[model samples]
Target: GEEAARAAGAGDLNVLIGYDLRFWRELSALVGNPYLSDFFHRLRVQSWMCAVPHLRRAGDLRGRLWSGHCDLVEALAHRDGRAAHAIIAEYNADSLGLIERLAGERSG
Candidate 1:
């Protein structure tokens, strides 16, 4: 699951990943949709969920999970539209590993 998600997200890091800084500008450029301010609230919740204590217990699972996100976002935004969104969708779909890890920490 993690591998698949990484593969998906590896393709479209911009459109799907919200914590990425480039999310808004690229979004505006592509779909003419501006970044909604409320998105940050969701971002914090999602990130906090990922950076929880248990996952980070081994001194990992904390910090930035995907620092490469913005780079991919920028790359995808400048490329084709449908293709870019598809890649982003792949990334969104592939987020299962992070979710699993997060769930594991929550349960344990």
Candidate 2:
């Protein structure tokens, strides 16, 4: 995951997205709940559907998104659930903000 994040930081969106899905899928599976795993899969796909266009428009993605993924991986590695949760929360908020900003640019 950290390697993927670094690739993403180098501007490879496909690598980032692919690894993100895999990361979440594995994490959800670790909970041993098939339902949650399925839900996460669907949710991730839907989010990509909505966000990909905007993301593509941004150019220079190197510093624009998912920079926290490496930190999240570190948190999980250390078994610090609280830190992991916070990192995820921050990532989601940042992603939403980026989408919103890009949408506004499109509309305006």
Candidate 3:
């Protein structure tokens, strides 16, 4: 997880995207629900496709963009559900904000 985060920080977007997709897919699979896993896989891929252009346009790839992933891994490893939820919430909000800003910049 930390290695993937570092790769992302170093501007290796493909590595970051692949790591994220695999992480989420495996995590969803842990729920033991095939339908849910499939749904999440499709949703994650679509989201990544929508964000790819904006992600590529960004100059700096460091900082919060790839942060929290290691912490999330730790939280999940320790079975801290609340901490994991908070991390996911923050990550989602931060990512959405970045994408929206990038999209707005491109459009306007």
Candidate 4:
């Protein structure tokens, strides 16, 4: 994830995509359920792909993304699984909201 942020910071979209894919893979592996993990992995990738154009148009998101991830990591580092889960849920909800808003802007 840090690598992805670095790539984005450097304005290297190609590298950023690669790093993002890797980050999702690593993230899914932590799910502890193969089927469920793969499902989420694919979903995240699809969501990311769909949001790319809109997100790019919205301008740089590295700071926002990095901060979200940092909060998640901080929760995990403290071994607070509940907090970590909440953070993940919040992050996902925020991302989905942004995607929906972007889609709306494009269509309307």
Model 1: per-residue Cα lDDT over 10-54, one tens digit each: 433332244343343444445543455456546645764654553
In angstroms, the error of model 3 at 35 is: 1.2
Model 3, TM vs. native = 0.86
Over the stretch 1-108, how does candidate 2's per-residue lDDT look in tens digits? 775678667878888888878877887898899999999899998988878887888877887776777788789889999999999899889888887788888899
Q: Give the lDDT of residue 10 in candidate 3.
A: 79
| lDDT of candidates 1 onward, in order | 0.48, 0.82, 0.82, 0.69
Residue-level lDDT of model 3, residues 61-82, one tens digit each, is 6663756778888999999999
Local lDDT at 19 for model 1:
38
Q: Give the per-residue Cα lDDT of candidate 2 at 72.
A: 82
Q: For candidate 4, which ten residues in a row score worst on lDDT?
A: 61-70
What are the models' TM-scores? 0.41, 0.86, 0.86, 0.66
Per-residue error for 9 in candidate 1, Å, reads: 13
Against the true structure, candidate 1 reaches a TM-score of 0.41
Kindly report which residue stretches of model 4 are placed more than 4 angstroms away from their true locations once superposed: 5-15, 60-67
Candidate 4 achieves a global lDDT of 0.69
Off by over 4 Å in 3: none
Write model 4 residue lDDT over 6-59, tens digit each, in one string.
775565555777787777677778768889878877886886787677777766
Residue 33's lDDT within candidate 3 is 100
| Lowest-sum lDDT 10-residue window in model 3 | 59-68
